[model samples]
Target: MHVLTMLLPVFLAFALMLCKLFNSLRTMEVQMGMGVVLLRYESPSLFWFVIAFQCLVIGALLAIIYCAFFILSNQVMS
Candidate 1:
C-alpha cells in the first residue's frame, strides 16, 4: 500500500511526460472519412492542466485512503 502511494504519482508523471513528448512530435496525418476530416491533437497548456489535475486528484485520494486506513487500524488496536 505504501509502495503504491509513491508509485501512483510517479506513474502519472511519467504518463504525462510521454504524452507531452508525443504531442511535441506534431505527427498528425489527415484522415478523410465520409468526406469529413478528422484531426486529433492536444495543446501544451491543456496537457499541463490535465497532468496537474491528475496529480492533485491522485494526491488527495491517497491522502484520504491513508488517513482512513490509519484511523481504522489504530481503532482496531485500541
Candidate 2:
C-alpha cells in the first residue's frame, strides 16, 4: 500500500505524457491533411516552434518522472 502510494504520481505522470503525445500526433495529422505543407513552406518558424514545444513537453514529463522516482527512493530508504 505504501509502495503503491509512492508510485501513484509516477504512473499518473506517465499516463499524462502518453496522452499528450497521442493528442499531439493526432493534431499534427489533422493539420497535415488540411494542407500544413503550404504553411510549412510559407512559415518554417511555425514548424520549428511545434517541434520545440513537443520536445519541451517531453522533457518536462521526464523531469516529473525523475522527481517522482527520487522521492520514492528517498522514502523507501528512510
Q: Output the number of the lDDT-best candidate.
A: 2
RMSD after Cα superposition, model 2: 5.6
lDDT of 2 by residue, 1-78 (tens): 574586687678767766655665555521434554424455677765765676677688677667766765687553
TM-score of each: 0.40, 0.48
Clashing pairs in 1: none
lDDT of 2 at 45: 73
Off by over 4 Å in 2: 1-39, 75-78
lDDT of each: 0.53, 0.62
Give lDDT: candidate 1, residue 25: 38
1-78: candidate 1 lDDT, tens digit per residue: 564574576567656655543553354422233764334453455545554664676566656557655665577543
